[model samples]
Target: MNIQETQINFTILNRFMVLKKKERLAHAYLFSGPMDVGKGETALGVAKLVNCENLSEENYFCDVCPSCLKINSRNHPDVHVIDNEDGGTIKIDQIRGLLGQVKMRPFQALKKVFIIRNIESMTIESSNALLKTLEEPGGNSLLLLTVSSLEKILPTVRSRCHTMPFSALSLRVMARRLMSDDGEFPQEAHFLAHFAEGCLGRARCLKEDKIFIQKDAIIDQFILSSKSEDFVKKILTDKPKTKGLLDILLSWMRDSLLVKVGVEDARLIHIDRLDDLKFFVERYSFFVLNDVYEESVKTYKLLADNLNVKIPLLIIKEKLRYE
Candidate 1:
């Protein structure tokens, strides 16, 4: 598929385009954003642009050049893409090997591009070893690093690269893309997009998640069940995995808030349960809902910190019941 038409907007990709046009492209670039937001695709586009033989004024690759064809086929000699190996970690040995290859000259194109996907997977030693090459990048060699979290990288390495921050796709945009692709998912798309918390990749994941349907059913039961004691106990005891359940509950609460405010453009991650969302909004006040949302966020943080999961789950259920 053409990069522009892949449910992502290249019109907004002008920032990189201008850099390429100015002939002042940075030797190293860090594309950091939410997962599945097209960082890897953007990096490939950059590589193709740098190596295109018959470049146009508006576009990067000619799509017909030998180099572009090689890149398309994943056999480009000058373009190297380093990713995780068997254990999904970029080892020191892999870094050393890539650095060794960097010493050699570009054979085909004016520039040799190296794209490292998931730079956060690099070990401390590998990252430290790469610092020198990053600081003093070789002539005709460009490095493209991508990570979901920039803080995971060493500050020294981060300082040497230009950073591009990608935001989550808006609900309207995501919904439109889904409708265009599969009309059956129009309603579900809007809900999933909102629940994804501005992440298109997460939205896609939700579309395929079997647990999402069950989560919707659970939220419905939670909203309607009058016997708080039995309901909370059943839910908490039945699903020992409270963290995931908490995330879903948070999403449901956010969806309710969006529905209450009549937010047409709300990117709801749990779109499949619009009926439940509507019911919750009708039953709860804004203040109460907002409090629940805030507390859920705290619970998420606590879960991340390895706190006792059952305590937060019990507290959340009690708060929902009493307040």
Candidate 2:
């Protein structure tokens, strides 16, 4: 997706345009948020905006321009990208080598632009090595760094750059996008939308995996199956796809809570399963549903930090009480 896409951070994009026009742009910017939520795309937009040979709107780059095309195609000499696009670690030497290029004058664009994707993948030494450039950043270059989480970044590194935090789009917005490329999903649009957590990239992957069919089974396992522990153990063993399962279970619990309190409406993610939600709600107290939801969310947090999920699930399993 392009930076100009509706799902991106518009507030920051407008601010960038204003800064660009007034020549008050920060030398370095850190865009941190959930993956595929437009951090990298906006960075690419800024790269093109600063170097576009033919300008369109104050906030837009002329896509047909030679410079824009080069940037888009990764042929722009002045623009450098260090993306862990494949599942690999970004090393110290790679950062060191790129920093050397950062020290040079721009070959064609007005300023060199470095778009470093997934900065969390950088080693401590690599992060430290870039601190000097971030502090001074005197080479008329723009450093655009995208990270999935800010916890891994050194506080010193964060202090040196302009940090922009991004959020996922609304469920309606993401669901609408998913429907554009319809038939990718076998489930109702809003259900997948809720499960996607407002990221189209995630929704696309869900569609690719045909994850819709598993939602009912995941819910049934949580609410009715006599083997919740074993089921969760199997899911946790897989690890990579666990969040999608968690998303399903969490959404179901959330709906159960809503139904318990009589707040059910369009806000419900599992409307088609309202009867199931009602029955599930009747089987548990408000405190139990809330506690289970909190535990599920805790599991989500632990997964984000790449930590063990055992503790949270132990609590969740107790609350669900499949036995």
Candidate 3:
């Protein structure tokens, strides 16, 4: 999709354009949001806007300009990317290296842009190494940092940059984009859109990902695990995709809760599976459904916190069969 067509954070993009037109843009900006929610796309769009040779109101980038093409192809000399290339962490050396480059003049464009993806993965030393550069980044340079959450970033670092909070798109927007992006996904469009948590990019990925189909089978299996004589043994012994399984179960439990409470279909994340969710909701009492939902939430949290997955999974299995 084109830059303007992004459903998430359209207001922020317009604000960036206004700032650029008024010559009041900041030196550093932190685009914090969920993954695949257009933070990186927006950052790259800003880079193009600042460097486009033939920018126009009708189109953010002329699309054919040399500068825009370079940025689009990720070949722009002035547009640098600092990511977790080594073992999933941005080290001190990388920060120092970026700072050294920041000290130089732009090679091709009017502005030198450094797009730092996964800034949350920066080590403490790396964060400190970049503090001075952030504080006094001289010349026509723009620092764009994309992170999933602000809480993981150092408070000092966060204080130095213009933090732009991004949110996921609505179900309708995601579903629409899914169909537009891939016509083949129309049959499963609503399901993937809801499952992606309103991220168009993620919806696209989920559409092509075989693991998603496996996860669906696992969820279905778990929902019927109660009938199996060795449900606990099967679940506890089987090597499950921990994060994916828990996330699907959480969505299922959440949708069931919503159905039980008479929530609007628009508000439900599993909009495509309303009948299935209703079936599950009817099989449990209000308290049992609420209890399972809480357990699902707690188990997901525990898994995210790096706790052992077996205990939590066992707990969820028991809770699921509590009846």
Candidate 2, lDDT over the whole model: 0.79
Model 1: per-residue Cα lDDT over 1-323, one tens digit each: 46555534364356666777788777888888878887877788878877889988867667778998898788999998988766488888877877876767899987899999898899989898778778667877889888989888999888989888777787687777666664636666666666665566666766666655657555755544554455555655544345557767777777778888986343555555566567667766788888878888888787678675566656666666733
Clash count in backbone of candidate 2: 0
Candidate closer to the true structure by lDDT (higher is better), 1 or 2: 2
Off-target runs (Cα >4 Å) in candidate 3 are: 4-9, 184-187, 227-240, 261-266, 305-323
Off-target runs (Cα >4 Å) in candidate 2 are 1-7, 85-88, 180-187, 220-222, 225-237, 241-243, 283-323
Candidate structures ordered by TM-score, highest first: 3, 2, 1
lDDT tens per residue, model 2, 139-212: 68899998888888888988888999988888887776676656534237777778777876777777678776
Query: What lDDT does the true structure give each of the candidates?
Result: 0.73, 0.79, 0.78
65: Cα error in model 3, Å: 1.3
Candidate with the larger lDDT of 2 and 3? 2
Q: Report the C-alpha lDDT of model 3 over 132-196, residue by residue, as the tens digit.
A: 88987957899999999999989999999999988888877777777776674543677777788
Ranking by lDDT: 2, 3, 1
